[model samples]
Target: MKTYDEKHIKNVVLVGSAKSGKTTLAETMLFEAGLINRRGTVEDKSTISDYHEIEHERGNSVYATSLHTEWRDYKINLIDTPGLDDFIGEVASSIRVCDTAVMLLNAQYGVEVGTELLWDYIDRYQKPTIIAVNQLDSDKANFSQTIEEAKKFFGPAVTVMQYPLNAGLNFNCIIDLLKMTMYKFPAEGGKPEKLPIPDSEKGTADQLHNELVEKAAENDERLMELYFEKGNLDEDELREGLKIGMMKHQVFPVFCLAAKKDMGSGRLMGFIDNVAPSSVDMPAELLENGKEAPCDPKGPTRLFIFKTLVEPHLGKLSFFKVISGEVSVGQEFTNEKTSTVERLNQLFIADGKNRNAVDKLKAGDIGCTLKLKNSYTNHTLNFKGASGSIAPIKFPHPKVRVAIIARNKQDDEKLSEVLSEIHMEDPTIEVEYNRELKQVILHGQGELHLSLTKWRLENIYKMQVEFIKARIPYRETIQKAANSSYRHKKQSGGAGQFGEVFMKIEPYFDGMAPLKEFPVRDTETHELAWGGKLVFNNCIVGGVIDARFIPSILKGVMEKMHEGPLTGSYVRDIRVSVYDGKMHPVDSNDISFKIAGMMAFKEAFHQAEPQLLEPVYDVETTVPDEMMGDVMTELQSRRSIITGMDNRSGFQVIKSRTPLAELDKYFSVLRNISQGRAKVSIEFAEYAPVPGELQRKLTEEHQKELATESH
Candidate 1:
C-alpha cells in the first residue's frame, strides 16, 4: 500500500447491535476492496475483525479491530467495534479517534436498544454519521419500517441515499437516489452492474431523488438557489453539499445493504471514500489546559494510545493515533502522563490480527508500535518539552459489582496480580479490596462484563474465584449522653495494679457544646480521626487521677470505637470525656488506666441507645412505559423512597434512594422485570439509620457468626 497524506485519510468506525451484520459487513467490505480473496463468515470465524479465540467461540466481536482499505487513491481506516454493552469501552475508545461513524441497523429489528445506547455515545462525541440498514435479504427484512423508526428515534436528518430495488428473497438490486440510477448485482453477488431505472420504478425513484437533492441543498444557501433554478444538483455540488451537511450533523444519509451476499456494499464503500470527512476536516484536538492541537505535520510530535493487545507471539502492541506532527521508528518521546521516556522502535499498521511494518506514522494517521514502557491507554506521548496532553476518552463508570473470594486460599496473592494485568487490558473492569468489608470487589459494566473477567482469570491465570454479594459498610452511632465507671484491680505479684476511670459518652455533632450540667471551665476537645469528637475535660482541679494517664485513657476509648458493642461495626459521631477517676500511687500505670477506660466506655455505649447506619444509593432507572409500573412497584417493595420521575427519550426515568443492602442483585432483577428494556445508574448517597427490625436481625447474625467461629 502507498502512503496517503491527512487530506486523503478517512477514519471511520463501524458500530451496531449484536448479530446486526457488522462483522459480515466488514468482511464484505474487505472482499469488495480486493483486500481479501474470500469473505469470512462469523460461523467459521475466519473474518479479520473477529480474530480472537473468544470472539470465534462466541461468534461475535469481543474487541475492536482496526483495518484499512485503499480505494480511489484514498486510505480508509475502518475500526470494527464489539456490539455487546459489556464492551462499550471498546466502542467509546474507537469513537474517540475516528473522524466519522458508520452505524449499521439490522433490518430485521429496527431501532433496537443497542442502537439507542450506542447512539448516545455518537452524539456525545458529536461525530457525523452515516446509517446503513443491512441484511435486507433476510426473510424478516422491513426496510420502510426501519426507515420510519430511524426517523422517529434519530430525527428527520436521516434521509435515504439508497433503497432496495427488489427486497426480500430476491434482493439483487439497489436504487441510488443521489445518482438516480439502479445497480443490479449478479446472483453470486460481487460487483454490481450499473443500469438505468426501469419504467416501473421510475416514479418511486423520482420522489426519493428529489428528497435527497433538497436535503442536500438545504445545508448550503448557494446550492439551494442553484437547485431552485436548475431543478437539480450537479454531481460535484451534491457531494460538496452533503459533506458540509454531514460535518454539521444536519444530514445523516441512510443506505441499504445485503452484507452476506455482498450486495450494495461497493456503493456504500464508494460513498464513504468520496464523501466522508477526512482527518484534515476533523475538529482540532482540545487539550486539558484549554488549548487546541490541530493536525499539522510540522508541529511537535505527539500520539495517543487507544488500544493495547498482547499477542501470543508478539510481546505487546500499542495502538495509537498521531495527533500532531509526525512520529517514526527510533523516535524517543516522553509520556505526558507518566513522565517516562519511550522509543518508537518498530511501528506497524494493523489489519485485524495481521500487522504491516511501517517506518513512520504521520499526523492524523493511526498505527501501532511494539514494547512501550509506562505508556497505557488514554495516555499521550510527545516530544521532551511538549506542554499539554490531549484530553482522554471518558469511559462509563462500572454499574455491576461483586465480592470475589479466592476458592483456594493460597491463590489470594495471585488473584490480585492476575486482575491487575486484566485491568490493563480492559480498564472498564475495576478490582478493589475493601478493608472494611474484608472482601475483594470486582466491578464492570454488567454481569457479562465481569463474567468474562472471571473466565479470563481462571482460564489464563489458573485461579479459582467465587463471586458473592458485597457486604455493605454499616456504622454504629449513639443518640443520647450517658456516664459509666469502671475500676481495675489486679494483685498477682510484688507490684499490684489498681486504677479507676469514670467517663461520659454523648452524641457529638459539629458545633455541639459540653454537657450543660457539668459544663467545665477547661475542656480540650479533639475531633476523632474518622468522625465525632473526644472532649478531654480536666475537671479534676486537685489532680485526682494524675494528668499523665489521661492519654492512656483516650487510647482505650478509641480501641473500643473500632468495634462497637452493638454489632461489632465501627462506631462514629460520639464524644468521650474522662472527667474523674481514682488511681493508686504505685499501680496507676498506663496499663491500669487503659483497662479501666475500656470497661467504662463499653458500659456507657450500651446505655446511649446506639443505632446502625446503612449506606443509601441514589438510583436512576430508565424503563419503557410498559415496564415502568412494574419497576416502580418493585422499587417500592424494596423500601425505595422515590425522589423524582420524568419521561426522557421515550422512556420513564425514575429516581429514588434505596439502601445498599436491598440492592444486591437488583440489576439482574430489574432486567428480568423490564425484559432488558431498562437501564439503571447508582451512586452512593448519605448514610441513614437502618430500620429497627433490620438492625436487630443484623446484630443477631453478627453475634451468631462470632459464636460459630468460636466453636
Candidate 2:
C-alpha cells in the first residue's frame, strides 16, 4: 500500500442512533468511491462495517469498523460505530481517533435518543461535524420536518447545503445550493444528469440558493461586504466562505441521501472533497513530555494509542493517532506511561478488518501497529526524555454489576484470567472479585453489555460461565441506645479466670461524633500509660472499678464493638463507655474481659433502633414523548422519585432517583415498555434506610439463611 500525505487523507467517523442507516450510508460511500464492487445490505449480513459474527447475528454494530476509500483524489478513512447506548464506549473511542464526525440522522424518525447522545459526545471532543439525513427514499420520510428537528436539537448552525429534488420513493436527485445546479436522475436511472434548475423548482431553488449564499457570505468579511454591496456573491466566493465556516464549526452543513438506493451520494462525495478539513488545514495538537509540543512532522516521534482490538486469530491491534514528529516501520519509541521502549515492527492503515502495511506514518494521521506487547489504550508513546504524558479520554464508571460463576469447577480457575484479558480489550468493563461474597463480579453499562462480555468469554476464551443475579450490599445499624453488662468466669485445672465488664452503649452520630470522655492529656514529664483511671463523673466521683483493670475492660469492649450483636457484620458509629468493671489481679486477664465485653454489646445493640441501608442510583433516561408517561409510571412503581423532566427535540429526558435493588431487570422492562426506544444511564447515589416492614423481613431472612448455612 502507498502512504498518502496529510493533505490527501480524510479521517471521518460515522455516528448516529441505532437503526439510523449509518452502516448503510458507509456501504453506499464505499461503493460510490469504487472501493467495493457491490453494496452489502445490513439484513443480508454482508456489510463491510458489521463484520463481527455477533454483529451479523444481531444486525447491529457491536464495535467500530475502520474502512478506507479513495474519492476525489483523497483517501478517506471512514469509521462506522455502534449506535446503541450499550456500545457507546466504542463510538467515543472512535471519535478520539477521528478528526471529523458525520452524524447520520434517520430521515423518517428525525432526531432520536442516540442521535442526541452522539451529538453531546461530538461537542465534548470539539470535533468538526456534518449531518447526513439518511434513508430519504423510505416511507413516511419528511425532509422538511427532519431538518426542523435537526435545527432545534443542534441549534441554528445547521445549514442545508443540498436539497432533495423529490420526496419518499421519488427521491432520485439532489440540488446543490452552492453550485446552483440540479443533478437529475434519468427515469431508467444510472448516473446523474447535470442540468439547469427545473421550471417547477425554480422559485424554491432560487430562494434556497440565496439563503446558502447569504449564510456563506456571513462567514467571510470580504464576501459579506461584497454581498452587502452587490446583493449576491459568486459560486466560488460562496463555496470558500462555507468551507471556512465549516472548518471553524460555525456551520454544520446538512445533506440528504438514500444510502440504500444509492441516490444523492455522488454529490455528498463532492462535499467531502471540497468542504472537509484536510489534516494540514486542521492539524491536531501534540503533547510531548507534558507540555504542548509543536505539531511538526519533523519533531520527535509521539503517538498515543486511543483504542485496542484483540482478535482471536490476529493477535492484538493497537490504533493510534500521531501527535508530533513522524514514525517509520522498525523505529523504536519509548512508552512514557510504562517506561518501556517498543519497536514498531509493522505499521498499517486499517480498512475494516483488512490492514494495509505502510513503511512510515506522519503526524496527524491515524494508523495501527501490530502486537505491541506493552502498548494499551490511552498510553502515550514518545522519544526518550519526553516531558509529560498525554491525557487520556475519560470513560464513565460502570453502574450495573453482576456475579459471574463458572458453569463448572474446572472453568473457575480460568475465569479470572479470561476476564482480565477481556477487560484489557475494553477498558470500560470492570472485573473484580468480591472477597466477602466470594464471587467474581463484572460491572458494565447495562445488562446487554454484561451479556456480551459473558458471550465473549465463552466464544473468545472458550470458557463457559453462568451469571448470577447480584445481591445488594445491605448494612445493618442500631437505632436506639441501651446499657448492659456481663460477667465472664472461667475455671481451669491450673488457674481460675474471673472478670466483670460494665459497658454503656449509645448510638454514635453516623461515624461523625468524636470519642467522648476518653481524652488524653500530656505533660512534659508524663509518659503514655496503658491503664487509666476509671471514674463515673456523671454520678459518684469515687472510682467504680480498679484503675489497673480499666485497660483490660476497655480492650474487651473494643472487641465486642467490632462484632455486631444481631449479624456478625462489623458495627460502626457507636459509643461504648467503660465506666465500671471488676478485675482480679491473677485470674482476670484480657481474654476474660473481652468475653464479658462481647456479651454487654449484644444486649445493648438489640435495645437500640436497628435498620438496614440499601444502595440507590440516580438514573437518567431518554424516551419518546408518547412513552414518557409509561416509563415514568414504571419507574415510580419501582420506588423511583422523578427529579426533573425536559423536552429534548423529539425525545423526553427523564431524571429520577431509584434504588438499585429494585432495578434488577430494568433494562428488559424498559425495552418492553418502549419497544426498545429508551436509553438509560445510572450512577451510584446515597444510601438510604429501608422501610420498617422491609427491614424486618430482611433481618428475619438473613438470620434464617445464616442458621441454615451453619447447620
TM-score of each candidate structure, all chains considered together: 0.87, 0.90
Look at candidate 2 and tell me the lDDT of residue 261.
79
- Measured over all alpha carbons after superposition, the RMSD of each candidate to the real structure, in angstroms, is 3.7, 4.9
Could you tell me the lDDT of residue 208 within candidate 2?
82
Model 2 segments beyond 4 Å from truth? 186-190, 220-223, 283-290, 384-387, 489-500, 508-578, 587-599
| Residue clash pairs of candidate 2 | 66-352, 289-387, 289-388, 290-388, 479-609, 479-610, 480-608, 480-609
Minimum summed lDDT over a 10-residue window in model 2 is located at 523-532
Give the per-residue lDDT of model 2 (tens digit) for 1-711: 666676677788999988888888888888988888989999999888888888987889988888878887877888899988777778888887777888888888888876766777788777778899988787788889989998998888898888787868777788878787887776434368898878888899889888888788888899899999999988778768887877777778888778787777777777777777765666355453356654566767788888888877888899887776788898888888888889999999887777888898877678899999888888888875454677776676775789989988887778877788777778889988875346788888778788888778888777888899876666555667677778889987767777776666655553335435443221111111211112221211245445555556555555554444544444554556655567676787667776776777677678777666677889998899999989998999999989999887778999999998888888878988987789888887776778888877777876897899999
Tens digit per residue, CA lDDT, model 1, 1-711: 477788888898999878888888888888888899988889987998899877877778888999988877878889999887778999999998999999999898776655667888899878989999998998889999899889988898998988997678888989898888889999888888999999999999999888889999999999999999999998889988899899989899998999999998888888988899977787888898989888887888889898877665566788899988888889899888888899988888888988889887778899998889778788889874466788988888887788998899998888887777677767898888887678899989888678777776676566788999888778889889899999999998888888898888888777876566554546666665545556656555467788888878877887888888877877887777767889998877998988898889999998998899988899998887788889999999889999999876556889999998888778778868976556777898877999899999999999998899999
TM-score, candidate 2, is 0.90
Off by over 4 Å in 1: 165-169, 197-211, 218-232, 384-387, 405-411, 479-483, 486-559, 574-601, 623-648, 651-656, 668-678, 708-711
